[model samples]
Target: MVIADLFKKTEITVKNIELGEVETLNELTPEQLQLIEKGLQTVGFELLDDKRKQIVQKIKTIIIEIVQNQSKILQKINPSVYIAESIGRDYKYLTTLFSEVEGTTIEQFFIHQKIEKVKELLVYDEYTLSQIADMMYYSSVQHLSMQFKKITGLTPSHFKELKANKRISINQL
Candidate 1:
């Protein structure tokens, strides 16, 4: 909402404020753009103007959206293909670029995001391990348990039993 408020202060109509999306009704002047960009930077949001940076941001946005929403499309499609199609870029190229820029492989980032989602579901206590496994598109409960252990050094059940919720913020993942 900070972003929306910033635009509002500028008398700019913000139609939406999803990750990597900011819609305005009218073209902004260079000065207006500069002011907005400065405001965004002040709040840790960068206006990505470089093509490569834009593509990388899009990839992160798509991955986070899919995992956080528990998207069923992942069950029917490979993540690589989904990202490539979504970004209109080759998977290999995207992976290479992401690794170069983010210092982590795309697959690793995806796994981290999935693990964070699992942590969230576990904390909510609204679903069984089997159900969460299925919802997260894991092949089985054992697979989820193994991955959960590998990433967090704690089994899902153990993590759930902790007094403190062991969940990480999605952005921090």
Candidate 2:
């Protein structure tokens, strides 16, 4: 059987591959699959064993969906209940699994994601810091600035001045 077939039989789904370009897991060569698996291993987080890796991927998918749909809204709308129901597991179970595997809570992961989004907005230079803060659900501009500084080691204004490449590809994080 093909390497991709092995992955499929193991219920592993590759993420972010383009549509119409080898849609099924069964299309990859053994070497390609090995390389992909190695890359995941090198990511330096213990929560990436086969089962936890799937759970992490699922959480990432849900976060991305929520961000895309609610980009304009500031407050945290409790994650849609549909997400937990759709995942076929209790939210508490998934969250505990995530924290145990990732060494951080899911809320912290979400905050990191939001901070990354804030960096993207700062790079764009289209929105004021207040606007960015509001968009990302920060309670106030100061709150956003504090969290941004904590994460990035620079104030938002300093980041704006640098105008450096601020984008962190999701997988790289």
Could you say which candidate leads in lDDT? Answer: 1
Local error of candidate 1 at residue 34 (angstroms): 3.4
Tens digits of lDDT, candidate 1, 1-173: 88888999988887677767787888888998998999999999888877788888899889999999999889789999999999998999999999988999999999999999999998888999999999999999999999999999999999998934555658988
**How much RMSD separates candidate 1 from the native structure?**
6.1
Off by over 4 Å in 1: 1-18, 23-33, 164-173
lDDT assessment of candidate 1: 0.91
User: For model 1, what is the alpha-carbon lDDT of residue 152?
Assistant: 98
RMSD of 2: 8.8
User: Candidate 2 has which clashing residue pairs, if any?
Assistant: none
Given candidate 2, what's the lDDT at residue 66? 62
Model 2: residues with Cα > 4 Å off, grouped in runs: 1-49, 68-76, 80-83, 164-173
Give per-residue CA lDDT, model 2, range 33-146, as digits (tens).
565566445553222337666766788677765655544433524653544665788888888888887898777887788888888888888999998777777789999999
Weakest ten-residue segment in model 2 by summed lDDT: 16-25
